[model samples]
Target: MQIRRVLAATSAAVIAATGLVACSSDSSDSASGDSESSEQDGPIRVGTTDAAKKAWAVLEEQAEAAGLDIEIENFADYSTPNQALEQGQLDTNNFQHLKFLAEYNVGNDSDLTPIVATEIIPLALFWKDHDSLDGIEGESIAIPNDPSNQGRAINVLVQADLITLKEEGLVTPTPADIDTEASKVQITPVDAAQTPSAYGEGTPAIINNSFLDRAGIDPNLAVFQDDPNSPEAEPYINAFVVRAEDADNETIKKLAELWHSPEVQAAVDEDAKGTSVQVERTQEELQEILDRLEEAERNS
Candidate 1:
């Protein structure tokens, strides 16, 4: 997303299973050249918060299958998309978690909703061969300093048994939550996107799939990541978000239908090469996940 503004301190935590406004994969570049020009009235304009262009290759196929053409637009930041959409700049947009979308609507007065889910890409924990999370004592454990995603990244560590929290911390957890005086490893929070590259200092770094993918490191290299079956999987999973009024819109439905098709799921596995896997959930299931995430954020 070539954001005119870098949005704000994510009003939410960094990496609970549900992804926030920022996505590191699909570089912040223009959507593929495959798009038809924007002037045509038959093509619908779809805006995205991240590098949706890459995944949008599939979207293009979906549109073709549905007998509609589209002009894909990309945005880097999570904030203000509703304003862009409601203002009629885009026919639809697919970015930000439903929670972020809900918060955006509450904060900005719009009625956006999800037509369906696409895929949930998990944020992974990468480290040099430290053997196991158990033996890496008295070492540096790098997380993010960003208020939105830091704690979510750390929770990955806790889930992997690398560290324990005195209690679950806020949207972003500070080092103090680690019982720093007694913890085996020294905890340090780096910038969210910088953690993957921060591995050279002999500390294990936690990063999201987008950052890790952008860094070109193999996902298999990561010592730990969220399990697909784990309770923490919801936040990391993503969806095709839209306006509430378009909940029944054919274009949006066709786009989601294409994504949920078995063919697309197989493509996600092949395209991601096993690094980032996709998930299937019903509309009701997506709603439940959103409710659970809100509950977790409230609890955190």
Candidate 2:
């Protein structure tokens, strides 16, 4: 991906206006639902946060060649796609990780499930005010405010030795969980969408890869990056999401197959440039994580 791709990632105002709707929970089979029957006539609608049309162009061509109809709709942020999927506006979505979807379900009382695993885009701490971690001492640092990724930002800071978290095994630590006395820098929380803009405010902000990519920042320059293969990163693997009812839908299963195909994986790797690591997990493991996250979210 190039500068233009970054521009596309951030260019959601035009699409958001038209694509985002008040996501309802009523998924009926009246052409709007994920009914296997509804997939017989037209292209299956898929949702993503960024415009992945180019990223999946090769896959799209291949799907077309195989007589499979699919269309990807890009949204502005994380919240809308699951809502749209639950409400039957989209056949499936591939924008979020299982933990994110689980959190969404817990928050909304919806049960959108992940049927296929995609890739893990590791979270990294990028700084504009400092060239090295040592220079970040005593500075006010910004991190993502969303519950799902907030703990991740904190974990990166912990890995960087900037702060210490009070809890032993917090899956989603908030600012309240920070051990201020032991911390070297002041921690501030802001919306995940605002993390990119949090920089240059006399503070180094910890930005996620999705937003960092949108800002066109070089991933290699990140002062610290989380290991995507670590146990902590298991919840962050992206996936194809669908309503619980469509878990067995043949078209959706086929779409997942196409997405995980070697050709498509190669295209994703070529375009992602080291930003995303392709991954696949057993369905049982994915479900177990989902169940655990659901329990955690409910408890939280």
Candidate 3:
């Protein structure tokens, strides 16, 4: 989860009540909803968020080259694909990270698992025309209004040398937890979904990649990215998620294999302009990462 989902984490329950549709438990023959019936079995079902269209296009090409057909469904909200998968409405999804998956599974009791990680997308510090972070007056910083995202924003500020943390590895940072008064930067705490709009007010904003891209900001041009390759990225690197039971399914294995191929990495490298790095972690590894995140959250 990035700042947007993090910001929505607390309010997620309320929103989940009214925002999400009922869960579905309809799984198909293949792990990702690709029927084993025949090659002519229409199309292989694939579900993902609206934000992931670019990456999936490359994946789609890979699938076609691998002799598999693909049908891509764009989900508006973040919660539907899993439910659709449970209902057998979809074959596979690729929009979430490990933290989101763990939280979702714990809350919903869904057995969704991730076979491999895809990209390390950083929740970055974005600004409209402020040349550099040095130009950002710490007196005012607009952060995501959501609790989880607020923490992420706080952490980003800390990373930019704009502030520091009371604890080294706290997960959810609150206003009261600013470590030092000298760096006591004021935060606007705008809603995560609205953060991209916060930039024009002469205030730097921290937001997720979707919002950043939606605002037409080149994510690569951001003043600072959260450093997904850093050791600190241990708790928050993003991944392509699926049901836990599908962890070893052949379709998932094939997809994961393709996702990890040199071709995919090359596509990412070439297409993203170095804004993304490939990630590949096993289900156990993801669980371990989630466990670490839970511990961080607990002590935050």
Write model 3 residue lDDT over 168-272, tens digit each, in one string: 766667877776675746677777777777776656778787676566777776888677877667556666555554555565557656767777677666555
* TM-score comparison, 2 vs 3, better candidate: 2
Clashes of each: 12, 0, 20
lDDT of 1 by residue, 4-32 (tens): 21222333233223443222222112122
Q: What is the lDDT of every predicted structure here?
A: 0.59, 0.74, 0.64
For each candidate in turn, the TM-score is: 0.73, 0.85, 0.78
What tens digits encode model 2's per-residue C-alpha lDDT throughout 1-300? 111111223234654477644222333542344445425335567777766535667767667766776666666766667766776667788888878888888888887878888899888887874557877789888888887888888888887788888986787888888899999998788987787887645558888777776777676777778888888888898888877877767777677778777788777776666677888886668888898989988988
| lDDT pick, better of 1 and 3 | 3
Model 3 scores worst on lDDT over the 10 consecutive residues at 1-10
Q: What is the Å distance of residue 256 in model 2 from its true position? A: 1.6
RMSD of each: 9.1, 5.0, 6.6
Off by more than 4 A, model 2: 1-27, 30-41, 129-131, 200-202
